[model samples]
Target: MWRIFSFPLSQIHPAVLALQLHLPNKHMVRFREDDIMSNIVDRERDKRTMLTAFFLKNKADETKPKYLYKDFPKHYTWNGATRTWTPRILKPQRGRIVSANPAEGERYYLRLLLSNVKGPTSFEDLCTVNGVTYATFRKAALEIGLIENDDSLSQCLTEASLFQFPNALRRLFATIMIFCEPGDIRKLWNEHFNAMSEDHQLYCQSVERVQNMVLTDIRAILQSMGKNLTDFDLPNLTEEDLQYGIHREVQEEYGIVVEAEDLCAKDELNSDQKLIFDEIMTHVDNDRPGVFFIDGPGGTGKTFLYKALLAQVRSRGLIALATASSGAAANNMPGGRTAHSRFKIPICVDNNSVCNIKKQSGTAELIRSSKLIIWDEASMAKRQAIEAVDRTLQDIIGVTLPFGGKIMVMGGDFRQVLPVIKRGTRAQIVDSSLRMSPLWSITKKMRLTINMRALNDPWYCGFLLRVGDGTEQSIEGSYIRIPDNMTIPCTDRQNSITELINAVFPSLQNNVHSSDYIISRAILTTKNDSVDEINDKMIDMFQGEEKVYYSFDEAEDDHHNYYPTEFLNSLTVSGLPPHKLRLKIGCPIILLRNIDPSHGLCNGTRLICRGFQRNVIDAEIVVGQHTGKRVFLPRIPLCLSEDDMFPFKLKRKQFPIRLSFAMTINKAQGQTIPNVGVFLPDSVFSHGQLYVALSRGISRKNTKVLVHPAKDFKQPGVYTSNVVYREVLLDG
Candidate 1:
């Protein structure tokens, strides 16, 4: 008879101990041992006997039992002296509990099981649960000799245990069962102990420290819910640990510190401005969409507040853009662009043409990347035009829902001029108008208060605001006394108006640094005239002032300097003299196209001409950039076709000679002129038109408006006809 002996025991036959342990379970006797050798032999044999007994027990328990003991092999010998069992080691099977006690490496095996059950798990998750680094785990596996240093089995195991913990651990248990037999666990323990580095050994000493603080915290929480540590799966533990760890890591990594107040204060703002700013900031903070309408009479610092908000946005690293309905309005504030230009919206000519082609092109890509857009002079933009921009933005940014990408700020007085379009019915007009849209509807309901206007001025601000609302006694005002120091006379309407033009033109030309002294006029000389008559008049005007104007034919063929010479010659043929002209490199010019009213020529319809060069017989007009399309205009006087007509019906040359006069209100958008001359002709004085024209010239110090009689000037809405009037008093 053989007996197995464990440490410090050598007195018993292991086979006798095993037989004794099994004899009782077979009958009525129970096996017990005081000696270590007997205990070792007894336990091993007991396992074998139990295995056989379990088969027999199942046969007895089942109603229809299969034959089992007939196929069972004979039991092996047990030696007490060596504590050995003589049966082949069986493969460890997955999901089978090898040990129930926590003391004999049960916790370590449990962790391995959990790791295998979870699939493709993160090291962070494992570290979070085990309170150990990947390096430490790898070193331990190597020292234990469970895996070779070159095998990478530990790393593979760690990688496979990412998110699914219980699953990964089960798989890991199955894997260990394949490689590790029941007899090999002792060898594994010795290898694991040998693999520990000095630091890891020291860390192992503090394992209880980590387990007590971190693991204990988690265990306690789970235990309160009646869960055993063994039953607490790794995934739940990982999630709990990871959330806490991530917060701690982020705080450490970013060094984030909360402040008591915002860095920039709003102490300088007025009540209304402060309210608007606060509202905008609140929306930004909450990531909500907000639309604000700052409606104020002229001179109310609406632009100033807009700029301040832009600065605030920039300081916060947010992208922002500003636009206006007209170039003049865009120029009202610094760094502003026309809405059409900013959004790359096409100027509508043919009703069927694409209204916003740029949005479909690369320009949309650019606009989508911007975080904020501010549109001024919104009143002048047609509903269709605004809609086109909105649609384009929505398409480019993939904003299926409303207000998707960035903040949009639109500023304009609705009383100003409406957009100009050619052929649309009343219903179409109503559908496409900006003021009638859902956005505007909501805005009107919100009733965003005005920030600045004439109310700020001591003399005219209050009066204009009241009159603009149509609540004042009358829209007219008495003629105020003109200062004696004013060079231009303000007595008679036309004289004062002409003097204002003469004074302002030189200043404008100088401010723009234009070297060419070119002044083209399109005067309405007759109510009814044939195309021939208009042509004859144009030719007469061209030939009338040869000394002042040199024809293109008269220009010398000096290619090196011909551009300036040819430009002068063209102007000279048009009644301007070369000697009087001062053409500068960067001067701004306006080019108007002669429209056939009978064909669809209209007041609001014109080409925006930029960039200029002089050729041999023509002046090359840069309609866009060098990369854009360009055209050449002959120096010779050209005739208008009989088909040419104005939208408003004027005689030939009614809006004649494609005059490039001082910049018009539309062209002057988004520009700041040191000196401006505003002509409020009686014909151009409707409530809407007045606002459009007045607002074009923004600076009070250098802006002047010439009107018929001061009493003839009428207030139609909240903004003054005198838009350039200063809010602050100027001491001369």
Candidate 2:
């Protein structure tokens, strides 16, 4: 047998290792190649040739099967015969346009040629010599009218379809696609473009050219929808365009437009309401802007007065921008928007922060022309948010007065959720409230005495007042015992929850899938865990086949993946959809994101699950002005950076919906329901929460509260906490 040598070993023989001949020392010895050849055959080169030939034969054999070298999941299978990878059957992508333009056709042809020939991208790459093919592309572009004399690159882009170019122009291509596609860009511009004046557009164009400016007047308008100057070409949008966009947005997002018959609603106002309405209207009539606050608990017909005021101003053909601090409240008022959305208030605000409104902008025009601005649920907003608006308004109107001397009607029960200072103490929370703002001193106080919710039941009204005022007889400092009539009598906590559910959602077995019946009431809770528990129980109770949807959760920051998939799956947090979302057909669900406001698919919008498909589901709006309207919902990427519960920022791409059978008290704050069931497994940790939860019911008869008793007290009676900050309630 011959030994095969590899690399450096080929130069050496075993005879060298056996040599003991000494050249420099007594023990050294050496042998010649002939000595080794006498005992061995030189077959190393032959063996090497055989191995090389074997590998070459395998490489050149085209008939042999090939398999995917990369490992894939079970769902993806590799076929050796076809040398292809295939996935399990899936529905084709929807709303995707394939044939966009001549450029796309050319690109497709190029791709086909490359596939067939397995050639390089360019002819130069295939050729042994360097040459140019720029003329070829230019000629093709000219033939298709994509290039013409005196045409700028921007102009050419506007004239051509997005798909005409390859993927190198990612941002520009995406923007163009948005303009042509059935999405936000077209919807926003088309609805508001004509409303902009030519001069305003010119002004916006000039401002947009200022590269060094911190924020331009034109960008202010476009930035509301995450749009920027780069999204459009020359002759950019004017201030008028931006204003119109805001107007259309307010129209679509709030669904609060006042109709001809809406003016007649003023005649139905109560005496207290009529007085406040007249007092506010007096300021509008005098052309003098005034700040007024309507102090009233929930169910006091506050929203009724909001409509009356909107009707009065709009009936005269004057603009009355109605807004609320919360989405649920915004929906209640016609043409209402959240204060932040309408004012373009910064998400993070400080004392020096002004709203993103510009003096030369369309929003400024709307504000200047508006006779009144109604901000409902004002108390829930941070004091800085209110001041930010005031500063921006004063700057826009060029006035040294409050809110730029604009007639502002702010309404909310201060007794409800105050400014939420995340993890702040009582002092911090009270100080952050709108009542603590400097504008509060100038605000004319208007109180709504009569509780329209408990109009027929004085007892319920009194109970709510005591709860709000902190006069409720507490077992300790803040803990109080629930009155008998307000609670469902049950010994066990589980039984109490069952009774509470039965009270709010009666005939569930029969009307489980009824959108109207299901949304008629909801179980309100203080904690997410309790809300989830109740939702699970209600979903299980619903009569239908359940379809489970899991979210793709990951960290937003580029850090270590310390948080595992299982950990994220088990999290229960506010303003986040669950990891496991189980829904049944016809079950009521609330939208977690604002998909389309014009179609009434805004946040806080209630919809019923209709059908499910790949990456999407069909839902019909069961609440708000667009009720009965069916819309398709797709899994969208969602991020929650504002929430501080998670260590690192969390991101989840999933359907933006959650079961509506039960929701948190914070979510139910600005909403009013005919029948409300308050399930307090744990006492409320924030101020105004208990009051907000209890006040959601239309009347005491329709509302029922069940609180977990104090530890070691396993009785039917309920114990609750009243978190009121007296400092915030004090008159400035």
Candidate 3:
């Protein structure tokens, strides 16, 4: 953020007019780091530190110019005789490279050795001692007395096995083998083989077959990492095992279980949905290409249509890809994944950007072979992201048409949350939306007017349309007055949130372990701060002992420098969980990052804490297609986006989850909570935030509001702002 106030340059820094002449050939002088500043001969009377005999530093003055210079730091001199400040440059201390996470393992220790030992030109030079080279950085560090042991390697694997899947574990093992040389590879394998082969054993039901399958998988993993099993003291793979099919994409697709209920979902589609299903199925049956879009408001059965389409394609033993803009929405469908993960779309995209998918890659093959591609919540994605997918698909399928002339069906509600642009203007946000994409003009558009979720509450459905359309009656300018019956009388902050908790999660103490009871409700707020406040309050009020897990936070580039551990712990950033996570048994928690979404771990995925251990949280999925799935979540390092306010990258090592008694309005998007309580101590900030929050429930009776506006309330009831950018919004 640039300063709003500015002053003349002359006043900000010293003038360069009084710089003295220097003779570099005459002599050389040097001083200790402390002596230069502590010695009186090199110091000034006004507490200015002398960078050198010929240079001055205003280190005590924050208003003075400060530059992060690697060498020849610019310094200024206060010329007492001329009553002016002169500038000079002098060499200063240098810093070493570091990473964000302290527990990054062997490479972390190598970085430490490099920081201190110095002067090593090559990898061999760093590990050489007495004219002999060590095998690894771990050995060198041990010899140099930098550390005691490489025990963290075993500990890391043990912790990971408790949470990660067999495939993720194999990849991690391969990474460890490449980077770190463990003391006993055989011992490591013998101990963790159960975890690495758990699934194979379950399926094969024979010790020999399971071991062979596991070895084959590991062999394949090693080849991908440019290594072989022979490199380590591990068991060798058979000649047959050395050869694995290149049909990984085909295997994963066929593994998608198609239930009879999903197959029957097609028969239940409404008249409007049937038109879209038939139109898209016609192209699929004929082996033709087309792009189609299903536009609708919230609860118009977009997910229902997606299930019917997926079922139609998959039941016939064909491939169908289900993707959504957000992980929460993606979890709602069968075999759904976020578009970014599925397409390998770059996080930071531009007009010239294409997906990271290569023609020979498994993801590329998946896209090429899939019969139908269904992208839900398309409006929330950036145009560039969609464009990248289109370009990559065209290139992969060897076609000159949009999405490589593939059968594409996208769906979204334009009145809901659009693409989130950091510090963006109204025009920029609208321009970044999918509606602004060139493909939007060519795609066949379909609309669903029936609000299936609100079918029983037609009055509530009409009210939501008004909120979405910005045609609702306003009490104070753009601020809308919520119906009194739908709002809790705001007496105080504590009381209001307490009332909301009762309304949303009633009998919390009695029904803590009941997944069905807690899974159906949520409380929404506009800000992260408010979400934290309400969650903390809810956890404290609940009938259980809270367990706190603290994160190890670090700054990667050291641009922000080594912030104290205590200070780093106090930070809370968007899209990341808090540094100190407070969780309890049976309390609702939401995944902050997308970890194994196919197993139902993703952002906005709600889970119930079954148990808590030192390194992992034992939890059960309470929502979405993978309900009742008990899984373990290990402490993983999470970093902030590039647009973070910090000077450098901030990484925190903790479970990628947050308490979900209350969640932000943005996180609450693409979700339907049976009972919702909107807490509004602060008004909605961005466009469509108010409309999205109010329309999260099936009926007005189940949805309640708790508004204690920061501004003084003068006359009658609670009122909050309804921000609707009508220009980009479509009416039903």
TM-score of every candidate: 0.39, 0.67, 0.74
CA lDDT, every model vs. true structure: 0.38, 0.65, 0.74
User: Residues 591-654, candidate 1, lDDT per residue (tens digit)?
Assistant: 3332111111112222322322221111222221111222222222222222123222111111
Residue 445 in model 3: lDDT: 89
- Using TM-score, give the best candidate's number: 3
Candidate with more favorable, higher lDDT: 1 or 2:
2
Put the candidates in lDDT order, highest first. 3, 2, 1
Candidate 2, which segments miss by more than 4 Å at Cα? Answer: 1-257, 557-560, 597-599, 643-647, 712-717, 730-732
Decide which is better by lDDT, 1 or 3: 3
lDDT of 2: 0.65
Question: Which of 1 and 2 is ahead in TM-score?
Answer: 2
* Candidates 1 and 3, the one with greater TM-score: 3
**Steric clash count of candidate 3:** 0
Clashes of each: 69, 10, 0
Model 3 lDDT at residue 609: 91
lDDT, residue 77, candidate 2: 41
